[model samples]
Target: MRLRGVKGSRNIEDRRRSGGGRGRAAGGIGGVGLIVVLAIGLFTGVDVTSLLEGADAPQTQSGQVSAQDEQAAQFTSSVLATTEQVWTKIFNEQLDRQYNPPVLVLYSGVTQSPCGGASGATGPFYCPADKKAYLDTSFFTTMSRQLGASGDFAAAYVIAHEVAHHVQNELGILPKVDQARRASSQNEANALTVRLELMADCLSGVWARNVQGLLERGDLEEALNAARMIGDDHLQRQAGRVPNPHTFTHGTSAQRARWFDTGYETGNVGRCDTFAAARL
Candidate 1:
């Protein structure tokens, strides 16, 4: 993706010094899990307990942010700006409304949110309570080294996907889904969660479609690779063979590809409805 001369979003809050500090009560989640939380929240409503948590405890204080910190800040803002432009046009044409952008918060290790306190290890997430997308820039490195996902576009995909959650929130899809999940059984909730996440992946594809003219040759592939790399199946394989489906949060590799392709190919949010689909 060519992001040269693009405007950085003004809707950003910098808090990079907060290390992925341990919270009073922490939940275990990985990069792939972060995607699931973000995705399902768009269509299945967010899981409050499942969403807030991290891996390690980093110190939260000054002197943690370096000069390079500002660069990451600017890059995140620029990527967010692109998503804003894409979604703005999408909201107007698709739903006949102006897209209300969400605030992007940059935090270090862990920080407090309207939803709860999250560690950097929890990855990037959006808090519907405060209408802000929280990110710890260090995760960009983690995306490549730990998640096996790379490229600036991959990072952009993460941001756009989270923004897609805000879109769902704005449309009231989140609250409705949240209510449904609360009334569901464990297995049922997981099923609904899968559908929701796939939809977010599809919605990310919608963003990609809107920016078709702006992407380079490998840009789409990079985003797809990100999806593939972070699938529940992929993470399971990384963990070990004998993967359990019951514990799977995000869909498998094939499902991820299919949903993402569905949105990008049609560029329509209506077609990205995962709940209505038989197979997620």
Candidate 2:
């Protein structure tokens, strides 16, 4: 990873330390239900616009957070900046268009996103409604300790995946998908969600491919491992539950890895049309 002198992104909005308040689970749902709640936010990018509407979040109280965590914030911002550069150049050279910059929000506990009032539990999400990416840096620690998805690149992939949704939104795919999801059956809708999630994984791979110099020998593997670790199947199994196809959202581990590999190998946005596949 030759990122020695690369410019970090200035699009970061840090709201760590003091947070507005805790987010309450709507109905005190069970594990599977809670997983769905978290998974939706994780997969399609958080709906900041819908989520933040009417949710009251007070100003954060003043308290010094860890300097180490602050460094992580800067690192996340740098990866974001690199993604912006990669996407912009790719769009201009390949598609004859310019990519608009999306704001990245970093918060602790709870913060307001264009989608809605964001809680740390929402994970990292990109709200199409507001076009901003929301994240809580503490998830990095959780990723390493609980999720087995460690490393800066693993963390960076999380952000990049959300950014990929932003790209999808720019392509006008999101609205169509949203409409289709609403009209489709629950099973069919989950299938579409799997495609959407896989495509985002592919988009992250596209970002990684363009930033070749920024990746090391095991970096890609770490990211791939992270991807596999977080698949719905893996998450469900880890929770000691049977894998149910009807409830699956992010697709299987192999499917996720394959799509991600697809993007990395092709590095072309057109090749990432997961929606057109006969099978994912």
Candidate 3:
């Protein structure tokens, strides 16, 4: 969590001042559904609708960054740089290939992505089409105040998880998974989606391990708590509903925490394979 002297990333595209001035299609999504989708996507992965949407809208642009926004931007850039380093080493040492890092786009209220036009209402998501991770940093505040997750490490976990989706894209897992999902029943697709998200959670843990020396006390717990906070069962219950395993696109709380722990403990990508687990 000590990010004071670390160098941030130059790939960051800051559009906080620009506002993007774009809106979602009418009747697209509301605040309540947005919160639910966010809680789901934060760790559980998003529904296919949001993931596969190809609605591209024109973007209007300009402005200055505030002190608070500037600080958040710095922290985000630094965390992204750390992911780049860790994943690069991982790709070279484990996969015997070069790691191409994704752009981390930092936007304010709204922005246009190749996948779709989104605001903080849609939450942080990775557009595989563009190989970019889009974020509205205010989600950090929402995580603390509304979602019961906090701390710098928790925020880092969110970023790392999104970056993990990019990792999946790089590894060809995403395309295959998408193909399978397209051919699957609803329950089956949900199951596959859960495995996909759990894998991302595990990948984030692997990143945590590679950066372990930089972590301070309680950092691991912070990430674990975050994983717990966004489980599908927990979010459903929090929304005053009964927990249904069949509808879960993300694993339960215990599964999420355990998968993340598996990666953190082993620090081996090979061990983080959720697809072959047979019990995830």
Candidate 4:
């Protein structure tokens, strides 16, 4: 959480000045209903392309950026830079390969991606087709206010998790998983997604472990709490619904927190092999 002197990433594409157009309700779901859906998607880090497929194109608008928004942007860039440094070293030493970092696209409201349309509803997601991570910094505010997951380190964890997806893509795990998912039943595919998501959670912890010196007191707790809060079970309970194991795209709260701890404790990429684990 001590990112004061950290350098910001030059890989950032800041599109906040050119607004991504005001979002409108999709499929007759508006107001609090829509927000709830967005919250669920954001926390679960699920690809909500189905939710956005037929939605109208967002109108572009211009707006002045708020100071708080600017600060969030800066923080995001700093965290991304740290990930770049940590992962670069990891690739060279561990994988014996070059690390090609993904661009972090900072957008406001809604944006377009090869994967689909990204709004606050889609939360922060990585488009494998483009190999970029997209984020709406306001989701950080939503995390603190609504999800009860605050702190800069918590936000950093979210960014790292998305970037971790990019790492999966770079390692060719994503393509193979996608192919498997396509050939799988709905339940089987969802299970594969859970492993993929939990693996990303673990990889994020690996990044956190590498940056241990920069972490302050309670930083790890903040991240673990965030991981717990965003678990599919917790999100289901928060939504006033009973948790259903079969429908879980991400793992349970305990599983998420445990996997993150696994990476942090070991700090080894091999330790994050969720796909090979008999138990997740």
Global lDDT scores for all candidate models: 0.72, 0.73, 0.76, 0.79
Could you say which candidate leads in TM-score?
Answer: 4
Model 3: which ten-residue window has the lowest total lDDT?
30-39
The regions of model 4 sitting more than 4 angstroms off are: 25-61
Lowest lDDT 10-residue stretch of candidate 1: 40-49
Q: What lDDT tens digits, residue by residue, belong to model 4 across residues 51-71?
A: 234432222346667777788
Which structure among the candidates has the greatest lDDT? 4
Off by over 4 Å in 3: 21-64
- Residue 131, candidate 3: how far off, in angstroms? 0.4
lDDT of 1 by residue, 11-99 (tens): 98876653444343254332222223663221122233332323222333463665555677788899899888988988998889988
lDDT of 2: 0.73
For each candidate, give its TM-score against the true structure: 0.85, 0.86, 0.87, 0.88
RMSD of each: 5.1, 6.3, 6.1, 6.1
lDDT of residue 121 for candidate 4: 55
For model 3, residues 1-280, the per-residue Cα lDDT tens digits are 9887789998898877775543443332222211122223533333433332343222223455556667778889999999999999999999998999999998876777666566665668777778888887867776676677889999999999888888888998877887787799988888888888899889999999999878999999999998898888876676666888887876888898999998899888888789999887
Residue 224 in model 1: lDDT: 87
